[model samples]
Target: MSIAKRPNPLFRNLNAKIAALPMIATTLVVFLGCSIWTVIYSFSKSRALPVNEFVGFAQYERLFRTSRWLISLENIVIYGVLSLLISFVIGFILAALIDQKIRFEDTFRTIYLYPFALSFIVTGIVWQWILNPSLGIQETVRSWGFENFTFDLIANRGTVLYALLIAGIWQGTGFVMVLMLAGIRGVDREIWNAARIDGIPVWKTYLFVIVPMMRGVMVTTLVIVAAGIVKLYDLVVAMTQGGPGIASEVPAKYVYDFMFARANVGQALAASTVMLTTVLIILIPWVYLEYGKKKAQR
Candidate 1:
């Protein structure tokens, strides 16, 4: 008797899925696994090597008590808030201006977006040079009979953070522009026509109608900017090296110096854990709100 033939399940085409599996596995193994391991290490008395000895909350205690760590945390909040606000404002303005049917639209767009393509390493050096009092704009302007001009924020203890803000806004506003421009482009043409018919000023239309409608984009932009804030290390390192005596220190740099430079793995891990927790605290609420909004829409 002939056996009944069945289709071969193993022969089904899963080439795309198979191809993606390795990348997915690598990301989980490297990124997620390392994160878990780091969190665990924070609880232990790990030094030059990751030790298994448990020392519950001691590292955290030390981290909190340290003045430099506290300063770094404060600086992070200031930088994060100011950078986000400034970048958003500048990006919105640029997007609005570019949307005005200006000449050389592509050229202006490219010029604005080019900074986002650069690594912070390059931008940081350029900014440092530009902000340097003796060698850069201040000196050059002073040479040209503008001796009273004072752009020495970079050298001032109280104002160095604002220098960072300037650099950060320059680097990040481009990305904000791209995001906001996309949102602006996606806006219904009919809305603009209706606004014109009602004799509403362009600025009023954007403030009252366009911006309110782009709340989703705004939130997404904020999240993107927040991620940059949480991981702010490279720019500080390249620009100031946390110097003029910890004047420009940030949390990531604090973690790095402790981890590799000082060989204080436990403290480093504690600092990292704090950073991770702070990001989660900020992100979770935003995510939940977005999810609820989407659900309500459905």
Candidate 2:
């Protein structure tokens, strides 16, 4: 008879654990710790400098009551929904078109993705010029036989967010296209063969089969695009500057202005907390459902 020994769990994968220490420490200290601190300070009446005095929900109430903040919230909803819809629609369309193995595939891909290389600020400035009435699309069209052509969308308050969307879609659609292309290409070749054998229409196969299989990629792309929408500040700054009277204001800008410009740390933190809550609300339920489905499949 021989004695058997059990392995110690703590010592298992010791090298990997050591390698991950820095990242774990950083996440705990920077993200978790700072989040707790912000939440704690948010309940206090902190101004330019933080104070210990507790003030309950005054900050939140004040934040909600402000007209500018309300307007910013409305802008975010409109921009967020439209941006998500358009990006996915145009991106998937472009990806599906290019996936046909057509001639000049590389050229078309490069043309589509080229705009993604430009920074948002640069893209905003370029679009600002293109949308300018005096020198851009409007002017060019007017210079032709018709002098009545007007293509200005950036100047009007009602249509200004749409102008921002036009620039955003131009800059971001390429990225979404690349992601969708990768996901579509990653679908198992056998699935396509099976669909073909079953005589399933191409559109139905894509709509019912491929889209379901690409949920992982879609989730990743959704998170990235959603983050961009939530932090929509630089583009608005470069193009509109919340102009036409705060028409393009976003939550991030509201937090910044409160923290820096107004020197109301508590109010800013309250705003920041609400922003975090908003992101969680948008993501948590979908993620939970995905997890449930995966567990059930397993």
Name every residue pair that clashes in candidate 1. none
Q: Distance (Å) between predicted and true CA of 279, model 1?
A: 1.7
Tell me the whole-model lDDT of each prediction, alpha carbons only: 0.90, 0.90
Which digits, one per residue and each the tens of the lDDT, describe model 2 over residues 82-151? Answer: 9999999999989988988899999999999999998889998999999997899999998896888877
Per-residue C-alpha lDDT of model 1 across residues 1-298, encoded as one tens digit per residue: 2223653555455687688888888889887898888888899988887899999998899899999999899999999988988899989989989999999999999999898889888888999999999989999999999879999888887888898888888888999999999999889999999999999999999889999989889999989789879999999998888877888899999999998899999999999999989988889989899899899999
What's the lDDT of the predicted structure labeled candidate 1?
Answer: 0.90
Alpha-carbon error at 4 in model 2, in Å? 20
Clashing pairs in 2: none
After superposition, the stretches of candidate 2 with alpha carbons farther than 4 Å from their true spots are: 1-19
Error of 1 at 67 (Å): 1.2
Off by over 4 Å in 1: 1-17
- For candidate 2, report its TM-score: 0.89
